[model samples]
Target chain A: MTHSDQISDSDQMPRSAWLCEYLARLEDEQVMAQHGDARILAPAHRLELDPEGWATAAKVAAAMGLRHAGLWADCLDDSALAAEDRAIRMQACLEHAGDYLVLETQVPMLRPVLASQASIYPGVDRLERHAHDLTGLELTSQPDGRRWTRHQAWPEDRFPLRGDFPLAGEPVGRAPADADYPFGRVQGTGVYEIPVGPVHAGIIEPGHFRFHAMGEDVLQLEERLGYVHKGIEKLAVGRDPAGLARLAGRVSGDSTVAHAWAACQAMERATDCIVPARAQALRGLMAERERVANHLGDIGAVCNDVGFAFAHLQCGRLRERWQRRSQALFGHRLMMDAVIPGGVAVDLCDKVVEELREDHAQLKSEIVPIFDVVADHPSLDDRLMTTGVLSEADARQLGCTGYVGKASGLAFDVRRDSPYAPYDGLAMDGAILAEGDVAARVRVRMAEIGNALRWMDRLLKSLPDGPICAQLPEAEAGAMGLGIIEGWRGEILSFIRFGPDGRIARYFPRDPSWFTWPALERLIHGNIVPDFPVCNKSVNGSYSGQDL
Target chain B: MFRILKKSFQTGVVTETPPDVADAEFERIGIELRRRIDVRFSRSLAIRQVDAGSCNACELEIQALNNAYHDVARFGVHFVASPRHADALLVTGPVSRHMEAALRRTWRATPSPKFVIAAGDCACTGGEFGASYASCGAVEKVIPVDAKIPGCPPSPLELLQGLLHVLRG
Candidate 1:
């Protein structure tokens, strides 16, 4: 522990002896920033460390029951240092309670390898792979070494997210047919494989799923995804705060509001900008509406996959109406780009608020009876029950959240636990189930929809009278900030660093899909092949969200 | 199912009347479409949708085409699973490099006389996710687009209009 920080620490110390005792085990450690109950900033303790200290710190943090939140990388170009010393810096963010403990370390360009966090947090398998894929820096024990974000679009030697690489990659013709990418072999008696798609039949995102099954039961399911890798990470560099917020919104179109808000929050934090109370409430409203719309659509789609056309039609109608309402209020149906760096672009007048309340009331009456019919249907009950069951152990290990984790008894909701603004005062009952089945997931979604509807009502009732936005001060060079939000699917984390003249040096929005997608492989292990679609729908991992 | 049926009976037909002259709010829009449609193809149009790396915002609006209000099915336009049965390809997003080939394979799979509708700002001009190391901007860069629907995600009404324009042409 550092002498300077021990005497000058901001948050005082020793609420828990565990944290203090653990830090005493390490050398050259000190708290970076303390943000207890801050409206915007995470109550994070940042530790600047050498390479060896970082790997050991991660292991210790994991043992202390800290959940691995996210990892992000950017090249650190120091003008004073020799060219060789300028290195790729990677930061690992870990969460315990509402606090985020961040570890930072740099690896020189010559042999850019570091110990992986996969041993501690198995969920970091993809994050390390993503760091490796984009920065060309290798992690010593990354669970998988295969290409991730780059796909085969870029050549072996070229790392697209590196500072030297141009935005336009020099392609030597069409990318070599990706047909030869290796798939896991499940060699046993009568174990065969079915490759689904990078291109699906219906209106859906692209991801290639390889299922190795014995008879009809799936023995192994390995998903090869990156078909939607849009070079968003590479594009994020050099953008202004507003531009970066727009890019974040597209990280996952469905979670547009949440992602944008997270990015904006990160930007606002970096610049020390405090948004108006009204703006925070509006953001909450938008995020909850997004959650409701997606749940409505998904509930219907799950039924549609099972051939319950009536439920499908009813849900579709409801979703459309909901989207229309969003458009009328937020100026975009999906609410894309509604959130900016300082505040929201649109403000709701009294008339709009009144209409929204009436619409909310009307929708409750309209959807409840239809949902009841589907809930009682014998055919649906037979299909969804006990199918693709993800156990509590698997859910916790995979770090799944939102409905997927809630269905399987992982009672972690970022909003309730973290208590960010607009949600700080709202009482959350937590819709959780231990069943770990498809039916349980549907029930969780239904419960969440009701909760979100009420949350909106509460937010509107206590809407503060103030300016919708605050003018943000100009960004300071090399400032860094982290933003985390409870998105519809789960907790989304955004990391932002500013370059010279306030241009973005790096921005990475870590989607909750990274945790949820891997768990799909586990949940679908013994499920039948035909049931994959419904199982996948129940999980509903976003391809774009993860690939980015 | 019986309860659902009873509710359906109580609600009567939730489906809109013939959109032309049915919704007076869009009389001018209906007249605009009625005037511009080329009417070269048959009345019925079968659509095959290919998501070329969209964030799926466009796909949601496209799916809404099947819902009650903007029922494109009532307009003799429905989404078919197979490209062989399709008359037009409704493509979305700036084609990611990984999806570029699969999109071509889909185009090749469709029978002759197929039209491609680049159905978003991304598909039309690479929108925000521009042509880059991992993305090949615009559906037009890889394949020809007959019609372009431009919006971050074109709304269901806008998509319906685009489809009507294609059917009329």
Candidate 2:
């Protein structure tokens, strides 16, 4: 049957309903549909699919306009399954509107291979390769099968995520260089390559960017990341709920609040624990503050790239003050480790609430004028406008989200699209633009800062009265949960499964960078090499977040 | 131009004084650090930062040193683009195995008499993501560290103090 024949009535039904109906039509006897844990904020549906159903599901989801959210896998202990059964379970998360559908398929240990979904969702290419490198899962019919996240740290035969692999695997005195990894070559005399990083010139995370350019115009920009992969998933094994929360916070330092919240949310959901209303509101408050701080820093960095030191300096000052307030209120500069499982670690009192209101108002007054200056400046506009354009079609195909996607006209904000606690019943405007350029991304960030400030004000005014944290119950072995949060960058999808003795079996925190990083490669097609820094600053995909 | 000038004038001098040393030992170390910088390095230091495998939180705090609040450059300290031009290497993270070669290459590229300051708990003690199949543990394991700053991510003020301590040596 043709792809359209399967989803002919998709338009007539709600997207989630149509998606569920489509999956149900797959007609595999092994396939089972069940309601996910109640604490998972989104309307979640889990399905067990055969290998054939797995490949077909991606095609159907793509045809139905469902965005490919994430792809991850975990190795199941051999003893846990029958001798003939598969030893690895792979999950593909697909989203429509705010609804999440998780598709699961098992792979045998000896020949662990599955059909690749990269053809349907181009962003899954890296994730599939990463899974292969870490879990020894191969993909048939894969596009670009280069090893990702493996840089001569371990041998080809070793799969670190496997149950038999020790957490502190055979250590070597020195790791060999990864000089043989093949980079896509651009032929012709005029096309030359600019190799940058793994150690950048600035105070930034490490990732190699190979730019094939003809003089100033960039033909292709390929990034080789995973330089910051510190075995986060391997380290997460056997960690208790609290310890896992701390590990999750470091998934991306800048995104500590969001990543921790996602991990904690997943754990809480898996254990069916309800976070108190007050704690939920506090988490929301910290998340919004994180959004504000990151946007401010990004806007400044973008300006600095184009010689607009005025905006850079001013934004830097404001960001410092903002972070100081966060430290005073939450006890950490970046507010890291503040969002624990079952609720928040810190609580707000009337005094701090009033102080925050004053700080918010002051920040608004101070930042608005600077933004006005940046918005009206001709030099800044000339540099940023029409540079690094990512078309709307490319954005949708890559499943870009957050400011990067919103600027390119893919308007999907998890907070607004799939309303969760604290954001539910709250009216918030999504800042979207169609220019798909550096200027548009900056404008979206400015708009988001304003929206977050307003949201924080409302949250403080209607502060819920309850305990900050709740007691978490032990989760049954093999229980699974998912958390999808709208971080400052974009949508962050976290997956967790409980092991024996209530420890974490598998944990995967998929950052929005997974999608946006590919979007960056597409966005820089014809931009000059000099503009790459500004374009990069505008997108600002978290290297550490993606590396992990 | 007029608006920009007016704004800059209104937001004049947000820079603060050098952070105060709490204990007598640190105060003594601070004085010695100042004297050594004046004597050995001619009162100017260029630091090259290497993020071996950090979560990028340490990088943020390091960048904050140059902001208006800290203005570390005013104290004769600045970040350089190359190791050859640097007098010290400020490293962060647990030194992942993937980054092992790169970190060693960076250290060897720096000239002699260059100090290496391990910034953040990860660089000092490997933090949460300690020695693993994928990580090489503390920075000192791969390179000799002159000083260490311990925080999940050391604050900008703590980073300054760490830099000073290393420079004193």
Candidate 3:
């Protein structure tokens, strides 16, 4: 069949109907779809399937108006898919010689060519672009042909995601030296270009935002990232599985638990290994704590950026105390290396739990007053209230997640939708609002802090006792795994493929920053250049995270 | 004010140290210059942090050193905005090809007496990213590294020690 002919016939249905039926089918199959009101899930069996069968299933999912939720193909035995077809359709290749694919195609991509899915599933715009970027697979009828992730690092002809790409260092050509990148400009009469930083005033990560403006109000903002791109994807290829988890932890310093959990989940899914229930709970606790810590810091930083130094000072104090408590309990301020492959590295002792409970109590009692001070003051709100508004529609279109999404009224949290581990056992009230402005973002942070405090209290009150980690079965060649964790930021998706003797064949971590960074550019419209710092702080897409 | 006072009370009374004892003492045999030298310190350092596509472990260590225990201000190496005013460039991770230009820009931004301290295995050489295609593999590739601090994620103390070396440089 021609490539266009491969497009399934069922792509014309309305998304609402398709989503409902998919969820119903998942429920019928005893697989539950969590927090996303629109998301659905279906499980696959352990046996190997044909490439055509896999493609057909993806086509059906696409036709049903469901994007691929990411595939987790676990190759446990030698009897996986046949070699020729496996080279193309496998979501990630395995070290154990096992096969798995986790594809997240938009509702629009399921149909045959002529009518592309990008128009319908706007959320998949960057996603499909990135997928094509990494895997070098041709996404038929993709909206734009521009290079998404490719720079001068690798051979232009060679695709890095291919199994044949060298893991060893290669001397590459210089990056695109032209000062002007493909950033769209405003069409108004008085629009001017205001280029700001791959470097900035504060100690934030490097991201250059090109603003097209008419007078004081921003007409448009386009972000050019990848300044700190380390080729983390290439580094992960052929690494030990455990090593990948450690690497995942640092994908974003503040997002350790989420990224680690996502990577670990991918590994577990591929191995078909179920972590102990308690480990799952502890992981959730860690994720929540991370979320709280970052939110606290950001709230303070936002205030500081706006010249409200008292709130900044107080928040800084609280944040410092929180980090100290974390250090006292987990041995690192940021809880680095506290999460491991099979489970967590740090487990809560009774003392640690008690200490955490004490900290939570203090935070809960004090935060309200601090936020009150923040709210009562006009200057703080004046700078924050409607500055950098990311409209609700734009949030959905850009697939903004975490506090940014919730602030903009997109109520998608992996914890609630996916319902993995401790999040399912405990309630996650992801505070959401629809204003889509800086103030709403701050409010979301405040609300999330309150919720996180509650989560900490609950976790401490009923701290689980168990072995923190488990010895994994020696991964044979071609073993594959998928990890999905709702990091403090949002969904952290890690796809791992193990080579023979348990080496990572390929590791891809989709940090939430990937989706959220673009949102920063979109949200800055109508705001003056001076307020960019506060707006950027409110969104706080990680430069390191996105670079990785 | 009352709430602050109450919080102080809740924290319990911290015994005041005597002037002579509180300060680190230095004595001459005959003339006891009892003029105690209080270690006057500043909590700010004009720090220039360099990134070499690090796993960010060393960066985390640097952040940890700034946090509670080994607070950089105790020795004074704060993360500053511009390198022109920075006392040191705390370089982290293996230098990647993409960051090479930025690293050079940052290095040139610094004024005289500026020290470049490579803060991790990756910063010292191409840590893991060294073998990979994306790596330029060390701070020396872009700038002369004054000190190399080793460890996957060097302990907060090690980072502090590296800073000390830079301060002394």
Candidate 4:
């Protein structure tokens, strides 16, 4: 598990210069030097490792302080390989400072397995399980082997991600009950367990929360999710760029604008095409609007959880009104399917832009006072202030981002640090807080909403006049691209590979919930059961996003 | 608090009348379902929602049904916590494989007069995420659906009208 000794003195360069030189030195036969190929991608460098080198490459990245971003598998063509060597391609994506490094290897299907990175990156526990369940590629030492994405839909041997596997799976009389899922237990004098939902009281996504508590205080809270998994990754294969973008938008309904934008950015990059400046601005405008809308809703929902109905009602009214504008200006309340592969589907005119500015100004006047009332309220402060504290170390270890990370002191923003297209020159200061509590999270969201509104104004005032979309040439077979965006929730990273006739070979859209959901489990320890709802509302990890 | 009190009076009944609920053409179905329900149950309806596998777009609209603008509670329609307490199950999504049994169990939990209303296009027809290895498309495929509302995520009023339609039978 430890590879630091193998790093040698040659690896002691500055962090930025280390990777390139280190990668070059890797060509020497002494260091993880299996028959592998390395290529520098626009956003990240990709290293296609031999099975022998895959684990070491991942360890190297993790040791260098690179956070695990995502992990997925791509199926290999069995026709080219001998029957015994027919394998599935495993991919591991790690993020450093701001750049990403995608490590890959091939594991034969007969006994397809790779060393688990969960030992190094505890966050990969679920992601590795997902790859195992879908692709039938097992990990050598994955600690928690309980089903992650596979919920007994397919039999043990039937892998859905395989090219030969059927989409309409053969189901015997009925799917067995998922009730017997083994939850971790606590055995003590005062410990008892409370199991809540796959069916919840409120109209929310289905997820089971098992709490091992001593009287009122929680000792542990383990979340059993994947109740909303619809096989989105398996469904994405073979879809063309436009079709893939549509699928991406539905990855999480609330994040339609951000997911589709990321997918389109990936496709545009793979095809080596640049959209017009106006198109980029339009994307920025839509993204900021989506951010403000979600934050308003979350702030309100947080208050509602604590019995502050007035703020909840006010925020709900504002969010509803805001989405109504999205419907008017973009033709859909959620702005679903508005982001196409080449560019956006709609254009903004002068009068519409002017009206939007006026509405934006009016919205500010209304929300600031509402925020003051909620912030100053003695009861709400008592409920939210110091509860559900996820320390800076926990947030960093789990790679939390968006409001969750910013609230907990992870100062990473894709818009500013890794600025794409429209955000190239935007200033993003004063949006980070380091308290790592429910109140800090709420504060971070409010501050983000404020910043987003200002960004929208700047974008609209200097709106460029040009074509909104461009003609994208068909992607070359074997072309690959990466798209990373700072979505409302946090950073959304998408990886795409093109096959014949512009079809997708593999697509993985990593939602920020991947990090924050774990942070939820960590933060809720030692808190009372009644405060669980508020803590959960604070993180607000999209079940659909995580389940996918 | 004074600001809220003043604004509350100034807003002046944002909640709509039962029959005049503005939405995506749910008025026709509302009238039809009202006729089908027994007078006893028509006075009040309780909904227990089971999200089989929805992306939660439908859940948001359903939540909005109870919001200030579209308060279904005023019309004697409210959401309950338990299926036994519920008269009908407002199901969403193209039933994910894991949730299929939970949906069936939820149905079994409800009493004999229990009904099912499939909301959202995914719930009605599976929408884009059709029958697959992970999903058994549509709510009716698992449990019988009495009423179906269709949209990517149906509007709040559409849900209101659909619930009325279900109550009729």
Candidate 5:
């Protein structure tokens, strides 16, 4: 209880002398030119810190070299929202104690300093070990206090991010099939060890890696994910922003429009709701047709896990003609709840937006000579140029976001770092690369499937018209919103809350496969064990979007 | 020239011998009917599926019987990889005790006349995670199913008409 010796908000002391007296009052208000509204809007002063004031909010975001985005742990409830300053400004600036924790940051002005960006940022060590394995909280010096998102899917003293857990898929029971699964291992001589899965051989989902080789050169790798968790944040606690956009489009069925547009932008920012600039340009043309049909079926399953069967039967016949033109334009072909709460559930019709501009102009004129027959062949560039590499400083010390940290350069892209709505008037383009291998993650997924087929032909030739949906109002109970999106496996944040009569008392989402499943065990070191299925299809990541 | 490729596969113009196994007098009923007609003419299935408390609407109609309109790998059905290279245990959902020991180690690692199917209405009962607590609702309470397929995720032509009713028995 020493972080800022507790005056409880507005000042206090010790999270390193309250981040050196709040960056010396933000460098004396940036030397008398008053640093514009003295910064503070994230997690509203992170509801006056505690839970080791998040290691004094990462030493005031590394004494200001800044650049930190996520650090989570939330359970805000005061009835969860039906409005009254959104349940009195989220139970007066986001409920701190009463259901117990808050800590989350963006840091513009010591934004409620709860800093332990994992001891001044080694990429907040697996986002503070998934907010202390789904919220029991305690992070006091965590460099790996084991249990990263607890797997045998629950019941090791039940935590599923707290607030009276039971969103109801069932099984708050059963444990002990040799119980011990806590994870850590890597010891020596031909390092030996194998494990593989929570069960595998594809039709995906369910995890558990282990590895520790010597013969295959992979000396350390450990992953043991929540085996298909399905309590989807406690059945999205009381539900209803169209049942949490059909449970965030089942969280990761190939990321249904980035989990139903980040659970309908956290139920339209906790019900101030707007949506309709032609349903945000048809939800950015169904999120660039679900990111060019999952980067042309994961660059043809990372070239059919390296045996390149004619670029896996022509990227499975161009992802089955982009899922039969998304079931002839949104009637679900993995489009799922097609973006809901206050906007979009269907409405592309103008002859399905001219058959989605003649099928993305024949998939950008047949993906440039089939990605130049997979970038000039030679056994698919000798098993994808220097195989599973990762680097840009181990993909920014493993926070590894989408297109596997934009092929390792890590530019970050919640539609260009938090823009929201029709990617704030388009132009978007972010396909960086610093050669983090597997052919720069298959040329950053074929340049993000040709920048999502030229931003879905400029969002279907400037789509516009009117109401696809717009009735929202209700959600006000205990408010608290925040969503984020981007998705084809990148940003996808979500948080939500609301309850008391508008329901959903906490929703959560997270999943950029929780920091690219620990950068696929640090990019399968010196790669071999039969090139872990083309390096796990070059970071495919979603085991039901990190087992929900 | 190899008798014009064996007279173009016996005048059928390339390949024609697949239709002779239907019941050729139950293959002369002997030695366990010729080992159940050589294990039903080398059966292929493998499957394992599991979901167990689904609304993945029969896991997208069992992933549209592996696309291309009910292909289910041209009827040999194969989705396998650990139910010990199965022969059939498809399972979808409603048996929740966190998938009852991974559906009883996917039915004691299949390797017999093994077939289970179940497919939908949350694996034949517990449908919407069947009043949750994480379900142990159906798929014949852990293993022996044989065939079920109902909807709410059932139409890849009802998962190729329930994988041809779990291959006719």
Candidate 6:
């Protein structure tokens, strides 16, 4: 179908119905469809597909303009199935609008192989490699089969996510340098490479960037991350719901609130726990605060990159004040551990609510004028405008989300598109622009900060008076839950499965950085090498979030 | 331009005075740190931060030290881009296996008479993600550490105090 044809159909029908009709047209008999649990706020349609159907579904989904949301694999340790059927279950999440469909296929433990989806959705490249690295799965017809989460840490034969493989793998005395990892070569006279950090000059997370450049202009930029991989999945294998929430909060410390909420949402849904209305509102409030704080810091950092020290300091000061308020009200600066399995850990009394209101007003007054100055600054505009532009077509293909995608005209906000409790009937605005440059990204952040402040005001006014938490009931073994949250950076998808003894069987929190990180590589094609920092800051993919 | 200047003028010098050394142990360390700074390396202390394998929370707090509130530069402590120019290395996270070599290289690159201060519980004692096949628990496991600032992530004030304590020795 043509783009126009599909758009018309998509506009006429609801997203779920349109998607269901499209999937039906694929005519794959092996595709088994089932409706997800009604308890889930954004319920996903589960699809059990054969190996052939798995590869075809991804290709068909791409053709139908479905965004590749997430891809993860879980090792099944059940001995009840025959040896031929004893397998690893691989799941691919495809999303369009607010609707979600999970495509699952089981690959046998002996010679686990599947067709690669990277050719269709470029964002799935690293995730497929990650699944392969951790679960010993092989991808046939793959493009760029380089090892991604395995950098001389584990031998070729060993896979950390296997049930038999111990959490604490055989510790080596010293790890060797990953110098031999092949980087794609751009052949030309004076086409040199600038290799930047696993340890950057600035105080940030570790990830290496290889820039193929000639003179000042960059030819290509490739990112080699996963330096912060701490066996998050392996460590999460047997954690209780509370323990899992703590682990999730740390997935990306900056995004602590969002990650924790997503994990908790997943677990809460799996166990059919009904979170109290007050707790839901508080969670929304905390998430908005988190978004504002990060945006303030980022807007300033982007300015700092272009040598705008005044904006940087002002933004930083405001962000520090914002986080200090969070610490006072929510108990943690990042609001980590505030969102538990069923509900929130802290509640706002009248006095605390008043304090929050006063702080919000103070922040709004201070930041508005600063943003005005930033938006109108001539020198800032000269550097940021039309620099490192990510085309909308490229963005759609890469499945970019949050400000990065919205700035580029691919407006897909999880909060607005898939409204959960607290946001269902809330008055909110999404900031979208088609400029797709550093300035656009910064503008998106500024707009988001304003919206969050307004939302917080509304939530504080309508603050419900009730219990802050609900007890999570026990879920039967093999029960799965999915949580999709709109974090500051972008969409955060968390998948959770409960074990027989009420412990976590499998947990995978896919950060939006998994998709946006590739967009950075695409956007930085012809930009000058020095502009890389500003461009990178604009996209600012979470190293720890994706690395986990 | 006028608005920017006017705003700057209105927000003049928002930096606050450092918190008074109330605790006896901290006061002792503060005095010792002052003496060391005067005698060994002038007043300025340059630190190179290495994210060994942190959740990035510690890094955020570390960055906060430079803001207008803390303004750690005024305290004669500032972050440097290179380890060679650093008097100490401020490291965070439970050293992941992939970063082991990089961390060691960084430590070796620092000049003699340099200290390594482990920031956050992960760096101090591996926090929640303890030693696994992928991680080498704690910063000290890979390289010698002089002092440890412990919290899931120590606050900016605690980090400043931790830096002062390490400077004392």
Report lDDT (Cα) of residue B1, candidate 6.
Answer: 89
TM agreement with the true structure for every prediction: 0.93, 0.94, 0.79, 0.92, 0.31, 0.95
lDDT of 2 by residue, B1-169 (tens): 8879989999987653323332234344445566767777898888999999999999999998888877766567879999999999999999989888999999999999889999999999999899998888899999998899999889886777787767655
Global local distance difference test of model 1? 0.81
RMSD of each: 4.0, 4.8, 8.7, 5.1, 25.0, 4.5
Q: Write the per-residue lDDT of candidate 2 for residues A387-450, one digit (tens) a residue.
A: 9999999999999999999999988999998767878757567899999999999999999999
How would you encode candidate 3's per-residue C-alpha lDDT over A139-246 as one tens digit per residue?
A: 566666555555556655665555556665355654433254577767868878988766665545565788887888877787776666677876776677678877
Clashes of each: 2, 0, 45, 2, 37, 0
Each candidate: what lDDT?
0.81, 0.86, 0.62, 0.81, 0.62, 0.86
Model 5 deviation from native, Cα RMSD in Å:
25.0
- Tens digits of per-residue lDDT, candidate 6, A380-414, equal 99999999999999999888999999999988998
Per-residue lDDT tens digits for candidate 1, residues A280-324, read 889889999999999999999999999988878888878877887
lDDT (0-100) at residue B18 of candidate 1?
A: 38
Which one is best on DockQ?
A: 2
Could you report the DockQ of all the candidates, in the order they appear? 0.73, 0.83, 0.31, 0.68, 0.06, 0.82
True contacts kept of 2: 0.84
Off by over 4 Å in 4: A1-15, A21-30, A33-40, A78-81, B2-13, B16-42, B167-169
Better of 1 and 4 by TM-score: 1
lDDT of 6 at A90: 91
Span of 10 residues, lowest total lDDT, candidate 4 chain A: A1-10
| Candidate 1 docking quality: incorrect, acceptable, medium or high | medium
Flag the better candidate by TM-score, 2 or 3.
Answer: 2
- Real interface contacts reproduced by model 3, as a fraction: 0.35
